[model samples]
Target: MWTIGLGFVAVLVIYFTYWLNKWSNPRCNGVLPPGSMGLPLIGETLQLIVPSYSLDLHPFIKKRAQRYGPIFRTSVAGRPIVISVDPEFNHYIVKQEGKLVELWYMDSFSSLFSMEGESRTTALGVIHKYVRSIILDHFGTEPLKEKLLPQIEVFVSKTLETWSTQSSVEVKHAASIMVFDFSTKSIMFSYDAEKSPMKLSEKLINVAGGFMSFPLNIPGFAYHKSLKDQKEALTMLRKIVKEKMNSPGKHEDMLDQAINNMNKEKFLSEDFLIRWVFGISFATFEAISTALSLALKLIADNPAVLQELTAERKAILKARKNRNSILTWEEYKSMTFTLQVINEVFRIANVSPGLLPKALKDVKFKGYTIPSGWTIMIANSVLQLNSNTYKDPLAFNPWRWKDLDPSVLSKNFMPFGGGIRQCAGAEYTKTFMAIFVHVLVTKYRWTRLKGGNIARSPLLGFTDGLHIRITKKSS
Candidate 1:
């Protein structure tokens, strides 16, 4: 009994010493940033996730930012994170990617979207460049001018025509379907109302929702479900890719382009190709859908904004004498006010909450030390919502963007992010939005139904399906 008691005492003492060392203030020059790490194992994971799950980076961040300045420490997604809201510092971090910091996501994210040998981490330098080049070539402005915009116009026209018949429609849900259809069709030439595209989108979305979930394999848990669905989605995509490769059919889509462009010697395998296809499709679909839904809802609530948007669209329609004329790239660039409204939507939505970059080594900034291996979250939401940057940051003011210099705006307004890994499909997203807005405002008027709110759930979107009633516009 005495021997056992001594052993237990020694274990407790060792653990106490370790805990003290782990949480202790630095022995080096700079101090750790101010904030709590919450409970031992869980840390502030719950505190971070609750508001995030509700689609707001509130109380946890806002409250802490108030108490601990722009930089603070918290634990989330099963790792210790340094949340930096300092705009300049955040910009510096992104600019210095691959040197000072490496992009990191939760384990579940890494697992679910694992691209074999060609992941963001594994596929660095030439491999990343190759994949990005392929994506850009397929989805870039030139491609949009040649192939995509006409299809988008058709999709939007058909969707609005359907919406006009219904007494009321859930705009977000409908918009999600529309974007998914466009994305799947563009990527894989697979889209149907009751078939593959719909199923694939739902499964991929479920996988995305569980990207930050705990890596537990319990049957009912989100992570388990994500892995399960991911395998299923992968199986479906692999079969499609195999069939496409085998078929000599000359399809003028992204899949065909990728297969033709692929060089196996460069280590770009069928596995990498399929992963890239589905990953890009799923990501762009959600982003476009979320942004469109929110933009429409915002325009509906703000009559003045809607009126201005309508005027902009009407002018374009008048210029093209035929009502059914396709939107031109020149016209997309000409909708300055419409672009401002979309920018404001991006700002307020903070659609992409924070850009994650892990510190490669111990780094000091703004009189604080961030330890090596710590995850640095460049909180874009904080910058967007900061009172210092905008006159009335919370207010949905599109007009503020009218006279702002492009250079000045780019520094602060990074909805698509900045640096080497900046969103490749930004132009694609912009074109989609411009065309959708032009078509909808010209053809139909919409009013938001009661009791719907935008929720974050880690992904910015409407909670109760942005319900709206639509009616055809009188010519």
Candidate 2:
């Protein structure tokens, strides 16, 4: 009887070993990257949830990449996630011929965007194609140079007028309003700043950002509040769309164009349009505001850089005969140092710290097998600050752009992400950030307020509000 019992125990041990091996191995044929995933079922969820995770992930991913090579798997939310940091791997993932992977986690964004049914899956793709085409047609560089610059100048002037009177101001809040107004007017061709439909739209964005972490709606929870907020936001958007549809004026703005010129095959419903517009607005606001705050903080800390940029701006303005007008896109693009500064800011700020991609099939890499149904995260924080890609990765050196080949920079840069799902607002965002930085540096001189540390905000932007004392620069 004792011999039989020992043999059974040995059999059980063998079965458990087989199961563990299956669980730990990557399914795909390629090399799997290396990383330690904490205890069972929980994975890295706790580490990711902590506010300091952004800062922590950089070092952790870098160490893993050094040990594991480009692609690796670790557990997240009770599932295995393959993280890819190699430029070649990233290119393969992003630039694949067709839909590489379905963005399942983006389902969370569906609730935020108020997309339902099939619309949720396809809304982002439709909006991307539509907005890119329309924006290029209407608000392209030439038009922005000729028409939008004047509009921006007027808007900036109005903003300065109001801000000049305030003793102390929250820069992020103020910048948020400014970007919101600019984006709304630019997209809708409306200048009714106070009564603009974008006010509630902005609130919807806030709700979306805050709602993601809350438990699923079981009634009377934070998720419920987000659902309610989302409904209110959609109602406002619908009202605006209905008003635009009824008005018979030649459709000049994006809203009108979307409603009038939609491709039946890919055309979005009116409700989809409303939610997309809001989504786009929020994305624009978040990217631009965070970029602006970072720029401000950088300028405040590096007086010499600020002086150089200011001098460059002065020289450019002087060469243009002191026009005292907003810089056109052409003019903005010519500000090479400004571009470098913004790029550096993005590198350090590292917004959109990671990309979540769901696996469609079992894929193997680096001796590990990542099974299907597992969600993969490409941690940008790891790649952006990797010493192999960036020298003095922590320092804010705008001139680093000058040192590297443009091709290398493009390949290594994960700021806007890569692949088919790259940020749709990349060009618009760059333009907005350039305009914002130019205006702030040229119009005002600011110093960081004593006892203020500009830390990462809990909301994925700068946390400290970037308090600075501003004194108008003498013309």
Which candidate number has the best TM-score?
A: 1
TM-score of 2: 0.79
**For residues 1-475, what per-residue lDDT tens digits would candidate 1 score against the true structure?**
9999999999999998788567543343467788777666667766655534343456677789989988988776447888988887887888877666777632213333435556455544455466567677778878888878888888889888999898888766677667877777767774453665437777777777676566677999988999998888888888888988887355467788777765443545677667776677677877787788888877877899988988888788788878677887788889999888888888888777688888767778878888877888888887777666777887888998877677766667888888887888898898888888888888888887764576664457655677788889887
Top candidate, metric lDDT? 1
Q: What is the TM-score of each candidate against the true structure?
A: 0.87, 0.79
List the lowest-lDDT window of 10 residues for candidate 2.
450-459
lDDT of 2 by residue, 224-257 (tens): 7777777777787788788887773566777877
Provide the lDDT at 253 for model 1. Answer: 72
